[model samples]
Target chain A: MVKKLPALVGLAVLLVLPQVLGAEYSWLVLLLNRALIFAIMAIGLNLLTGFAGQISIGHAAFMAVGAFTSYGLGKFVGIPFWGALPIAGLAAGLVGYALGFPALRLSGHYLAIATLGFGVAVPQVLNLWESLTGGWTGVKPAAPYLLGISFREDRPFYYLILIALFIMAGLAVNLIKSRTGRAFIALRDSEVAAQAMGISLTKYKTQAFALSAFYAGIGGSLYAHMINYISPHDFGSGISMELFTIICLGGLASVNGSIVGAIFMSFLPKLTERISLVIQKSGAFEHSHFLQNVFKNFNQVLTGIILILVVLYLPMGLVDLWRKTKNLFTAKGVK
Target chain B: MAILELKGVTVRFGGLVAVNALDLSVEQGSIHGLIGPNGAGKSTVFNVLSRYYDPAEGTATFEGKDLLGAQPHDVINRGIARTFQNVELFKGLSVMDNLMVGQHHNFRYGLLPALLSRILPSVKREEAEKRAKALEVLEFLGIAAYKDAFPAFLPYGIQKRVEFARALVSQPKLILLDEPAAGMNEQETHDLAQLIRIMRDKYKTTVLLVEHDMSLVMSICEHITVMEFGRKIADGTPAEVQNNPAVIKAYLGEEEEAANA
Candidate 1:
């Protein structure tokens, strides 16, 4: 399952064609674009939590920091998107590294609580800081780096996000398959064993935290460019919850799982609306109040249930499940 | 020359002294044994050497260097590696991957080299070399078929073998094996003895083994240091230790002592 066999090869073609085809179709394409960009965010979080074995509940705070940094840089310094892009990422990464010093002492639920507090505190502070952050007023991001190419519409924004996501994803994939990734996994599994094996726990733990933050920053930079504007609300508690939801649903220790999760969360509301419309026409679902309530409030409950189930039963995540099923069929005597 | 020396070492947790004023030394290029009854501080001394526990009062010197102030990793970097009494294997990782991780401290690739390898095709020759060396170690340990297998899936004996393989990958000057043969059967214990000798002969590894099994210790250890209540009772050749009255009283009862005499 993880062998990367051109799975969903035609997905981009099927998605991008609709945007150029018509007006209403273009709106769906825009949503798909946002989903892809968010997938980068999910991928970064996965690298931190899954591969690196660091628990970061306030990952969205780091994202907000990236977005704000990009906006502040683009507007005040007259820096274009290209200049602020990496700068924003670096800024977030530095903060992440600093945070790692404290966060490393804690693990699992305690670490989560610490980052969760950071997540709550960061946005509120941004909102209160009127002079730098424009308080609750929000900031408008400057245009793309090139003077000739202004990203006015969703399609242009789509291409920029796609490129950014691609770069970040490439970096993440290469990194997690390397020595650092092995160290992270080892530290995650057992600190005593890792130390026994001669791994410097303090050094590697901090590295994982910093690298994960860098990825999150890149995701935020891409997000800022796509949206063209940002407010404290854009990166508040709701954003943190959503990022947490994506990581949990996808699997804690997976890369492609994040992409799968992002796509699912992005398309869910739209799919639910469509399903409701079809069911309303059928008359049975529409006339029954109980069934109608189930369809209406079902998603939030379903997401909650899925998170709980994945934690308890499918802790290895979807990727391992897919691998096992594939192995079942491919086993020597099975054929 | 003494490779590792402990002087006036004492470890106290509140009212209990796990090890008290213990003076000991391990010679260079030799298999040294530390044996004690349960809770006699055999493991406590190992912990102090690995920098896991700060001594209440002691001077630990490794190859003329003070070992007291060094971090656990700095100790490893300074050519001291150790295993745990309860096998601390990275259970989620494959056996080969675990050994490869062990060699992380000795990785030859620079930052630019690491980046360059990723960009280049054909498996980044150096990484492949490291992987090949890891396989070589696996083959040497006779668990190469289990290379891809997770440590959790392996039998206890094979896992112990893999842990030793990982420690050797670093090519450390001294290896502190904390009860390497603790959970092994007689056959596995015999194999472990052979592997220890092989490691000493092939890698020129100086080994300090903490074991409860007197038979394994007597069979493999050229020199033995006996501990009782965290203090060294005797230190000499295995025969010399066997003959010592203090060693006999600490390890065996009066009835067995009388029979042996």
Candidate 2:
């Protein structure tokens, strides 16, 4: 019960926040929604990278597949937002499943390079195909609607992202506890042992890719609908790197860690911007715009510093830190 | 009757020839031992049986079925499970979870059922039952206290026993235990020998173990196969192999060669 109290409180806050806060905290609401969407993507990547021990730097490419699929299905095929979501996931999943073949042949840094090539290729493909994707300018998908509620604004749409997060989070939790989930961890620990235990490496690896893509696809669909625009510029290697970093920054092999990581990533820029505003007004670097630019890019620098610190001091990430703290307290009390 | 048979099995890594034209049989409900000196290809035989290394030539049959064609993953489904020379327990997972992985073949529920386990009572029941079965295996191995603890935290002897429980949880017809007593103390090795006998007596499961521990091998195993430089030097009962001049020369020759060099 103690373990579940925070999530229950969080759910209540999510349900009540938009109604109580009004327009003053509209940005907060939007940020939360975006964070939830990214959280969904991070959860998927955690399974592949943390549990399955496969490095994929092209995660955002799967999201791109999803976003464009939603656009194509919604705009060209006239599919409703509800209908387009699963279809978009399917499209991305199929592509991810195909990528698993190359993943099996390559590993470690070679796998990272292969996935980087894929990450770079997706946006190029989006830009090159002038007819389907609208080339450089990209496609502008309309705001999604369903059941008499227009999700043109951030408040109502927050519920959709929330619901998706809940379902996907539940699915991830369920998966990690099941036989297949055990197989994934086994694969990460020792492939030879896992194979000896009757886990098909090829089958599980592809399944991990497909499932990760499905989550990414759902997140992309939500993103496309929320942003009301689709452009190749919206996705790049940077976004994929962010997704990978979020999981690592939060915790590996942890569901709650992904959520925490997504929230941190989503709010980081705003936090930095606020700091920059304070720094600019304080007259610390009053003479030059170059110094102001430094403040503007402070988030990137801080992110790099944090990544280094996390790698050096907290290799298992924040989740392990939490466990250590809890263990310390419990041990003292018991003693 | 033999549960496993290897007829003229040969495995070569480049030109090294790890195992050469080996013929071996493991009888059902018997503790069989494969013993040899270093680089004698004892572990290589286990690898070939587990299908980790495909043999250059030969046929391996398990319970009258052609085992050579079976995929590595399918070895457990065909009622064969193996432990590694260096314990391959999932260090991240708890000891119980590692055993649960052994019961992979028993999980009949597909993706939907697993995902919706809370909503569906039957799936919940199956999951509970699986957990119970895993706990039972842990209790059987006398490692129930460490079930919730990660394998890395456990002592080396306990970790090896957990690996044994893991393979046993699958209820395999034949288990290939590779160097189970490698890092164990004398007491632990004696305990493992007794456990192997109990496993054979109570469960009637066949065991094919590869080890360099002569006392444990001679005490527990009804039959033994000795290898030297990728070839069978001797195959007989413990006393017979002890008396065999070829087996003595096989061990003495290696030490003498090392001394002379």
Per-prediction TM-score, please?
0.92, 0.95
What is the Å distance of residue A96 in model 2 from its true position?
1.1
Q: Taking the tens digit of each residue's C-alpha lDDT, what string does model 2 give over A134-200?
A: 8888888788877788999998898888889989999999888887788889999999999999999
Second chain of candidate 1: TM-score? 0.91
User: How high is the lDDT of residue B119 in model 2?
Assistant: 69
Best by DockQ: 2
Candidate 1, A1-335: lDDT as tens digits: 34664334534653465456687677876787778777788887777787667777788888888888888887788787788889988888888888889987898899989999999899899898766577778777655746577776777777777677666766666665567667778888878777766678777777777777776787787777777777776787677677777777766767777876787678776766676666656777766788887766655565556557766776766555666677888895674
- Chain A TM-scores, per candidate, are 0.88, 0.92
Q: What lDDT tens digits, residue by residue, belong to model 1 across residues B1-261?
A: 999889999999889999989988888999999888888898888888888899999899999989999877777788887777777777767888888788877765543233234765543665677788888888888889999899888888888888888888888899989999887889888888998999889889799999988889999998998888877888899999989998778767688778878
Worst 10 residues of 2 chain B by lDDT: B252-261
Candidate number with greatest TM-score: 2
Q: Candidate 2, residues B1-261: lDDT per residue as tens digits?
A: 998999998999998998889999988888999999999998888888888889999999999999989899999999998898899999878888999889887888876676666767787788889889989878877889988999988888988999999999999999899998898889889999999898777666899999999999999999999998899989989999998877877877767656656
Query: How would you class the docking of model 1?
Result: medium
